[model samples]
Target: MPRKDTCKRRRIVLYAVRSAEFTTSDDRQTVYIVETDHDTYLFILFTSEVERNLYLYAREEEVSDEVKENFTNLANELSFDPEAITYLPKVPVPRRLPCLAPCDCPGDAPRVPSPPRRARPPDGLPRRPYGARSAQRQGLLFRQLFEAESFTYTYLLADPKTKEAVLIDPVLETAQRDTTLVKQLGLNLLYAVNTHCHTDHITGTGLLKQLLPGCRSVISRDSGASADILIREGHALKFGAFALEARSTPGHTDGCRTYVLNDQSMAFTGDALLIRGCGRTDFQQGSPEALYRSVREKIFTLPGDCLIYLAHDYTGQTISTMEEERTLNPRLTLPLEAFVELMNNSNLPKPKQIDFAVPANLKCGVQDVAV
Candidate 1:
């Protein structure tokens, strides 16, 4: 399969020709059929202007034998064909809905369309046998690391092409483990970025810099922590061809920032938002009002399909979607006033590590790096 970014630009173009017509056009256009739980989509790849013009002018055909056979087998298995094609299942064209496009092929075949529709699974067959990483995330190397002592999550994101990477919210005790993993993976660690200074645990950004030469520590300027790089909203931390766009979300801490990938497919939301709950706004300049707005405005505004990766997950849950959190978050669903009241009234005890952790994190977790 092609890279995820490449596939996103592909369009489903229907042509009247079949196996016999595969020889008509040049090698500039190729057809692909994708099957998902919701629907089946036909994709067209036009490599040159001449091929696109030919396809638009007369809807000529050209498909490799391997692809042609695959399409035929898939169509037969799914009971799909030109005449039976319908527009009910449409692939969203960005945000707009394109119902159909005119088909200029020889026969009276149905026009091409896209959408999201429910399709029943075959008898005794599961829609998806297991959960797996999406093909759309193909070119990106993403790892979710955990520190059991603090129940914290550290993220390692890298561009597979260049092996340039950044670690998000590394814990002090686990810094060596993370560093070893990076070296074993042959990656060039570029940045150890903290979303904010933490009260429960020290940040490994400072230790990571010591362990991995050339690695810089990044933190929001508002965090008031000592770091090699201080960033603000709209700052882009890049590694090779990819970048993490920072969005300041300062309710949990004055320095909390959410790092969203350039493609908007995933986000590293540290303490700002969680699977179903949110961070406590009881200390470190924490404010319910600011948090509510931060989550609703900064985090919720991302695409619904964007996956939410958190800095910490107390429960076993590790991931969520923007849509799920927007609709299902218990505290966020309430009116602003009610939400604020609930948060302000909670008398949760101070974290056990606050005294030492806060001071250590303020310096980016270097002095206590003995472990």
Candidate 2:
């Protein structure tokens, strides 16, 4: 007739909490007793917890309410008291020795983690699981975006069809996760393509070349600093029925390229067009006039419904459409006359490495940085 305090069942096992709380946008007072758990797990109780749960829910099979109901009904039939909650198994498990504090050891702190090793995926970049494309579609495959050698958003795009895949931009942290997922998905490397000459993003092209011996490398015209297949503007890369076209949008950088997956209505603008804005033009042989014309004359001219896929999101917002950007991006909407005037009057500070980076990026990011 009675039930145990199932209220104690917390989604997370945190050590402690005063209570749980949820807030409506602009309304922070509607706090509630979200489940409580152990202390170490408190980190999972923040707003980030919801994001983590959403990610996990996408990856794992969800527990259905039917199964839960059946389990409860069986327990009730067995006359199990729901009012009492007991967790102690009363069985001894192998105990692990606690690590002593390093006060007695000076060398402990010196053991810094070594740099992430390079990923050699035959010859291409590795892709990971990126969740659903839309509300009604299943997650075709996984995608992992990483900061590659040149600080590029290296991507691993998988083909759920043949379980074969390609890597877009694999930075060096990408190797660990890429190899793990590739093996997990039983996929093979097909090709590695660079949207264009990348400077800020880490370049894993070299690393991928080393790992994947036979994978083909696709680079926009004169992309690979050393050497590779030149992807001229409007080149169509066909994969079975799937194809991607290289749309040259030269303004942010001379060789900046955007790859459009026409079937998907999405164009991956490496650094040309971001989610809500455009990349800064203070770096790498940048000319504000050139950037203005590129965004106005080239990218903005695309179908208003074109979905823009950004490589960087410093502002946190993800993918958006050209229509949204047209209505929202101030930089893109500025009149030509005003744009030139603004640039002339703009006193924007130079990029961190303007002293040495600008010239380097123009040369396809072959910079000689002295560390």
Candidate 3:
């Protein structure tokens, strides 16, 4: 099994009104405490200095000034920037306080539980007839594949009637697994499509071409990458009767393209957009300014109900919707300058595979295939 972060020394505490439950004291103002791996501390969620003062104004006799001082110092040590904090709606549970929000707490902290999920299409919705005359009657055969090493998501979309299929952002290590599944499903794999030239993991397009003859590779022409087919803005990549409308969204990389299904039911946003985050613009011709525009204009313009599929998700999320992302994406929701500052200052660790992945991915990840 792939190793995942189980627990990272994080906890939550809520200060409630004297009348509310979960209060630690009986004095009109009460204190809440949380325990972590290292020590016990008073925890409160605050966005600005003003809010911090509100949290600090506990009943002085009940909670000592010394304890409040320590809390203030800890919050400062964590560099509580207003831009970094994301506030969530307070959920109303029976006895426990609903999760409030998450912050950039010290250490590999666990995230606070999110509010109850919104309604979505049912998982077992019966597939429509393959060749039905009505556009609404056609069903898409979709599969989401994962490569644990790089935390990448590979999507396989196909037409149920013709079995014509496309694989998006496939990784080199899992080429055989994808090939086996395609064969098992009797799919005629038509295209191995890449949304952009990746840095973290080598592309599986080349291997797929070799494994499944006649399968061509696809990428954005601006990506400066070699491929069997180069697509551009407004291009349509058709397989069977359905097509993917290519929209240039180049903030993550010069070549990033978001592929929307013809009917606008779904969009494959490469590294450009993520579950509650977005692609890093620290390298690979990354421009926070350009990415902000791309998302706000090209992606946000889609229908609110359009389903969003992404290239990678670290948090085990498989899908999201336009309405959810437009409203909830922490990074993108920021104003342009704030978004730029946040992206530029994210001191993320370098990807482990960049050195080899970039060179091979430029050639459609073909160089890594065993001859």
- In terms of TM-score, the best-performing candidate is 1
Clashing pairs in 1: 89-114, 89-115, 90-114, 90-115, 91-114, 91-115
- Candidate 3 lDDT, 82-191, residue by residue in tens: 23323333322223322232334322133323222224335675222111132234367888889999888898888889999989999989999999999998999999
Off by over 4 Å in 2: 1-131, 135-152, 222-224, 344-371
TM-scores for all candidates? Answer: 0.67, 0.55, 0.64
Backbone clash pairs in model 3 (N, Cα, C under 3 Å; residues 3+ apart or in different chains), count = 0
- lDDT digits (tens) for residues 64-83 of candidate 1: 44544554564443224423
Q: In order, how many clashes per candidate?
A: 6, 41, 0
Each candidate: what lDDT? 0.70, 0.48, 0.70
Model 3 TM-score is: 0.64
What is the alpha-carbon lDDT for the whole of candidate 3?
0.70
Ranking by TM-score: 1, 3, 2
TM-score, predicted candidate 1 vs. hidden true structure: 0.67
lDDT leaderboard ranking: 3, 1, 2
Error of 2 at 251 (Å): 0.8
Enumerate residue pairs that collide in model 3. Answer: none
- C-alpha RMSD by candidate, in order: 12.9, 20.4, 19.8
